[model samples]
Target: MRTNSPETKKTARELRNDPVLSKEYTKNKIQFQNYYFKLGYQWSKPDLNSIVCRFAVLIQVIRIKREELTESFIEYDTRFLGGNFQIPDSKELLLLIFLNAPLYQVFTTLRKCSKRKEKYYKDRVGQRFEIQIGYE
Candidate 1:
C-alpha cells in the first residue's frame, strides 16, 4: 500500500467534495477509520461515511494484486432487483484481460498524449483510473 502523502490528502479532499456522492455516511465509522489507519492514513478526524474516505478504503481493498483475487468465488448480477441473473466468471476474466492488454494501453496513451493543454497526464490518469475501476 502507498503512504499517505500530499497527494492522498488532495484526493481525500476531492472525494469529500464530490457532488455526485449519495451524501450518506457509513454506519461503521470506527471500523472504517481503523481500516484506513492500517493502510497508513493519518486522519485527525475522519468522516467514515464521506465519499472520499470510503473511496480511499475501497481502493486499497480492490487494488490487491491480481493474483490475490480468486476466480472461484461466484459473482451474481443482481440487476433486476430480486431476479436470479448470474453472469459467467469469464466476463470478469475478459475485462481483466482487456484492461491489462497492450491495445488498451496504447489507446489510453494516445488519449492522454492528445490532450495538449494537460501536462500532468500521469497524475490525472492514475487518479482517474483508480476512481473508474473502483466504481466499476
Candidate 2:
C-alpha cells in the first residue's frame, strides 16, 4: 500500500502551493462538502492507500445530454499489486467488460430506481470505488 510516500507528499505540497490549482481544489472541496453536508454527512480525507491501491468500480456521476451512464471497474496491474492481494489480468478484464456491459447497466439502473431521470444519480453519490490513475 502506497501511503504518504515522499513523492506523494511532494506532489501534495506542490498542489497546495500553486495558486491556481489550490483555488480549484478549494472550490471543488467546498462544493463536495456542501453537497454531502445537506445529506447529514461529513467528508473525511480518503485513505492514501485506498486512493493509490486496489481495484475499484467507477460510476458516472454526471449525465450527458444524450448518453447513457454506465458502470465500470478499473484494470488492475501486476506491477501495482502488493502484499497478499492477487488479481489476475484476465479476471480483471472480464470483470471490466461485465460491469460496463449494457445488460449490467440496465440491471443496475433497474435495481436502483424506477424513475428514468433519477437513475443517473442513483449510485453516483457518496464514496465510490474509483481508481486514482496517475498523479494529480
- Most accurate candidate by lDDT: 2
Query: Which residue segments of model 1 deviate by more than 4 Å?
Result: 22-24, 27-136
TM-score of 1: 0.18
lDDT of 1 by residue, 2-74 (tens): 4588888777788777766523432211111122232222365454343222222111112123233444422
Cα lDDT tens digits, model 2, 19-90, are 777644322111110111111212364444332222222343332321132222111211222212233322
What's the C-alpha lDDT at position 107 in model 2? Answer: 9
Question: For candidate 1, what is the lDDT?
Answer: 0.28
User: What's the lDDT for residue 36 in model 1?
Assistant: 24
Compared with the true structure, all predictions reach lDDT values of 0.28, 0.30
Clashing pairs in 2: none
What would you estimate as the lDDT of candidate 2? 0.30
